[model samples]
Structure formats: C-alpha cells, structure tokens
Target: MKKISLILSLIFLSIGLLGCQQSGKEEELNKEISKSTQEITDKPTIIGEIVQIEGERFLVENKTEKLPDGRPDAVWFSTDEMESLKVGLIVSVWTNAIEDSYPQQANAKKIEINEY
Candidate 1:
C-alpha cells in the first residue's frame, strides 16, 4: 500500500541521515588521531653534553650547532632525574615543548645517557 511505502521511505531517509552524521564524526576522529601521530613522530631529540646543572635544571651544550654569536648552541631543561645526571656526560633528551629564548628552555620528558 502507499502508506507502507511512505513509512519505509521515511525509515530509509532517517537511516541515511544517521549514517552521514556517523561518518562525519568518524572523519573528525581520524583527523585528530592523525594530528596526534604527527606530533609524536615529529618530536625532536636534543643530543648534547651536560654543561651545567642548577637545582632541577641543567644546561646541555651542542658544540656542533653554533649561534650567530659564535658560541655553542645550548638549551636549559628541567628534569626529574637531575640527581642522576652530571656534568660532562652526553645525554639525549626528548621534550614535549620548548620555549624560544637566547638559551632555549624545555622540560625533559625522557633522557638517556649516551656512552662513547
């Protein structure tokens, strides 16, 4: 009958609309996941020697990278394992964020001592 056909059409339309909305949500979620993956993949690692230690913060010096002022590139980082670190030790530091400054500053998310 015509009434049955109308009801069926409405149901199909509703399902189609719901499916479209669901796909939109899935697309948004996929974009967010891709962005997060890119951030983690592109995260930088600073490899240098511990030049100075101040409280919970330490300065890492990379002699190969130089500044316009002709000094070695250095960055100050705050770490939870300062007690385990010492001067003259080469370290690899993974950071979540870095602040722009004369001597860059960052918080170490991970640190590894590299032995020669």
Candidate 2:
C-alpha cells in the first residue's frame, strides 16, 4: 500500500510541475502578443519635409527620427494628397502600414501642410 501511494504521489508531482511550466510558457506568449498589439496601435505620425514626389507616391525625410541603419528616416506616402505636395514642403502625414513589404510603405490617409 505504501509503494502504491509513493508512485501516485510522484505522478501527481510530475503533472503539477508540467502544468506550472506550461502556464509560464503561456504567460510569456501572452506578453509577446500584447507587445505586438501595442506596437500596431502606436504607429507613429510622421512630420517631415517632402523630398521627392512622383505621381501618387512621395518620399519624405523624417526630421524627428532616423532609421535603424543610421539613415535619415524616410517615409513613403501614397495618396491623393500628392496634389498639394511639393518638394521642400514641410507637412504632417497620417499613415498606416502596408502589409508584407520590406522597409515598410505607408498609405497616407491625410496630409496637413505646416506653415513655416
């Protein structure tokens, strides 16, 4: 009877340890998911001078930040807003991420010209 009880106790302890480890992994996954969600929600609004404008797409030199590679951060904008844009113009652009692209492109939702 004592041997049976010992085996049962070991089995229960093993299950408990497994459950704790699984819960720890789940919590870590949840934290990662939360961080990603926050990043998506916190997309930065870019304020920059228009460097180039080609048809419906334009490139802006972001004065407020730099890219990870130490290049002056440049954002690409695609919108009807191009009608009012000119090279050297300072503007604020509201944007959203383009899915599945390297150096990520943004779709400009609105553009407001800032008076110098």
Please write out the lDDT profile of model 2 over residues 2-115, one tens digit for every residue. Answer: 999999999999999999999999999998887545433343467889988888988878876887878776778788756678999998877544534433477776688889
- Per-residue error at 7 for model 2, in Å? 51
TM-score of each: 0.61, 0.55
lDDT of 1 by residue, 14-90 (tens): 99999999999999999888754444224446789999999999999987888888988888999788888999999
How far off is residue 20 in model 1, in Å? 24
| Candidate number of the best TM-score | 1
Q: List per-candidate RMSD values in Å.
A: 5.3, 6.8
Off by over 4 Å in 1: 1-44
Q: Distance from true position, residue 71, model 2, in Å?
A: 0.3
What is the clash tally of candidate 2? 0
